[model samples]
Target: MTTIDKHKPILVTGGTGYLASWIIKQLLDEGLSVHTTVRQKKHKTKYQHLLDAAKQSPGKLKIFEADLLIDHSFQEAMTGCELVTHTASPFKITGIKNADKELVQPALQGTRNVLFSANDSDSVKRIVLTSSIVAMVGDTIDIQNLNHGVMTEKSWNTTSSVNHQPYPYSKTLAEKEAWRIASEQNRWDLVVINPGFILGPSLSKRTDSTSISLMRQLLSGKFKMGVPDGDQAVVDVRDVAKAHILAGLTASANGRHLAAAHQKDFLAIAEVIRKKHPRYPLPEKVLPKWLFKFVGPLMGFSRKYVERNIGYDFVFDNSYIQQDLGLKFRPFETTIEDHFKQLVNDGLIPDKRS
Candidate 1:
């Protein structure tokens, strides 16, 4: 493992994100100075928690303004930093008017802009990017084509595009672009952490990302009618953040690491939550696939998509992350329990069990 010099500031893009905030916190705990990038410096309220963390930690925290669409915006942040953690990729499943403009361009171009600056910086040794399981396999049905029914780091997403699986496609292209840029020059090594459906408490109250927003829906009684039958790979936000830090400092770590715990469907989550807080409007049953096929389109899901995916089994070979990075995963049940507690603590849901 490469020894991290505490004096050198590590750059963390999208520092305000749920996962990135945890990464910043862990680095601070290690007495490593952190340089974080956000779009606005004027938003002090958004970063005050970081200041709180810094005060209690041995590390120093510095924030700089940077935009993904703007060229060279991250240059100042990347300058003089020995390590970079790029977790700023856009993730939105709905309300996107232009998928290419909003999702594709920012993700691919952001990697270029950040890596270009990192290459120019003399101190940088490695970069850790926050990728998603979406980049590993498009849907649960992808297991059928796999040799061992496990989605590993060796796999690449083959079922995404602007027209379909747009979010996954953006991640795949962005990671590929990062590799392409890294190969063109040997200045820095790249490590990608591909987590699946990250859950647990979010530092910020914002519900922009799909995971946090899904939590909002659960607490808001949106799924009280019936939970979707679709399954997903799950991971904790804290674990994902820790993997990023481990990947950065671990010298032997390279390529992609799948950071997921297990495969579970929406009904599984509802069952857990329902058991914890019976008074909450948690769904008691799974919606039928036929219903999903007929009504899913009205809810914005494509009919073809509903027919092909959902209500299936898929596996993620997270063994490489534990073996290569020497990291351990928290149980999936613990993630759900902690996530529910956070929702209640944040007032997103009331303490019904009490």
Candidate 2:
């Protein structure tokens, strides 16, 4: 285990992101000074909340400007930091016009740039990467090929590319690149956290994250007709943040940790919200698979892909995270309720059914 004093000033990339913000909060609460990276230092006003938190806590906060694609952009921020948490990665399921330029290139290049900086930084001891469960298995259909019913850290996403589930493909390649680089050197040990769909209260008012956008769609009646017959291995955002810190400080922590809760389908998620906040118009029915055949294509989803994925079950063995990092999960119901309450309080959602 890492001693409190041995933990040097940490550097967190993508500090403004929905998940990374919580990681910063936990670290600061422990009285550890953190140096966070942003695209522009002039965006200092962007992280005023973090500054405010630092003032009340015993820790300190420093800001630096770094771009994922730009070479040597992270050098200054990485200097003398003992630990680095690389959390910045593009996450968009739609509106992507170019797969290479938009998804793949940046992810691969970003891993290289950050790890190269870690190699040069003498003070850095470990690099913890924020990966996703997407890297563990590509799609629900992949379960047929495995002997075991569930996915574990030993599994790798073998069937993913820009043509299908491109987001998962990007994460697979980026994480592979991280391991490839780490194997060549001995300066910094690498640890990766592969979390499933993250959901919880937001640290800011921004609604750009896909998970948050899903909540917005639910409240706005975007899918009032019905929802696709799909399920997600959900994990709370705060739990994921706690896992990251635990992995960083734990001495024997040296591999991937799958931070996920029990699997739940769309109807399951909607049911939970409906119970807590009956005012919200949560989706009630599962759209017919045949109807999805027509509507899926219009929504930029391949009909064949939907047919293969819909109504399938995918399980994850989270014992590794529990036993190794000593992670305790928040009840899935609690996370759902917390996020829904925050939504109503923020005025982004109404207290009555739409």
Candidate 3:
């Protein structure tokens, strides 16, 4: 069992990020002091939401500037922290002109840098890593070969490479590096929260998050024509945040815990949104696999990706998270409904019907 100090301020990297923001809020709501990192210290506009949240909570919030690739950049922020949640990593599926430079190096180096700092810090006892289900399975087709046709913590993505599915490749490599570093030391225990396609509201209005961008595309009529028949394990952002807190504080929590709530297709997600808000131009049908395969290249997806992922169903075993962390996921309808409502309220997505 690992010992954690509730009074000592906990450190959370990437505080302004979509998932990290919610994690910070949860920690503050519990009246726990939070120390978080951002890329720029002077960019208050980017992180003002966090400051505002801090004002409303009883817990104190301290902001620090740290870079993912810089060695020991996190040491100052981690000085008195017993628990560290590393959530900073690059996540992009497309517009990759150079995969090794854009995705892999940052992720691998960032993990190394953070773990190295954790090793240097005598106060740190537990580290909760924010990993993705993509690290378990590279593509939906890979699920067909699994023993029970479901992905679990035992799975490792073997098909992803720098040339194909670079985002997943980066996550897989980063997580492996974290494990390798953690195994060499006994001072701190490492717990990993591997969430599925995280979808929900954001604390910031920034449209850069992959989740936010995807949600915007869906509600903005980008998929009004049709969506591919692809299935993915979905989880709410709030539940994922709660999982991190549980992993960090729970003495018995260990190893990789998958945090997916449901497995559904794009059309199913749209249906949920359409049910709540029928005015949006949401896609009502799934595009034929062959049609997507032919036109996918034009939309930045490689032929191999379409071949391996389209028209396939991917599922994840979330029993470990529920059993270990005692997590109860929100309904998919609630996640989708809340997410669209937030976007509309924030004016991130103007009502096209208007």
lDDT of each: 0.84, 0.86, 0.93
lDDT of 3 by residue, 73-137 (tens): 99999999999999999989989999999999999999999999999999999999998999999
Residue 45: error of model 1 in Å?
1.9
lDDT of 3: 0.93
Q: Per-residue lDDT for 42-71 in model 1, tens only?
A: 998887788788999989999999999888
List of clashing residue pairs for candidate 1: none
RMSD for each of the candidates? 1.5, 1.8, 1.1
- Model 1 vs. true fold: TM: 0.96
**Which parts of model 1 have CA positions greater than 4 angstroms off?**
1-3
Model 2 weakest lDDT span, ten residues long: 1-10
Q: Which TM-score value belongs to model 2?
A: 0.95
- Name the best candidate (by lDDT): 3
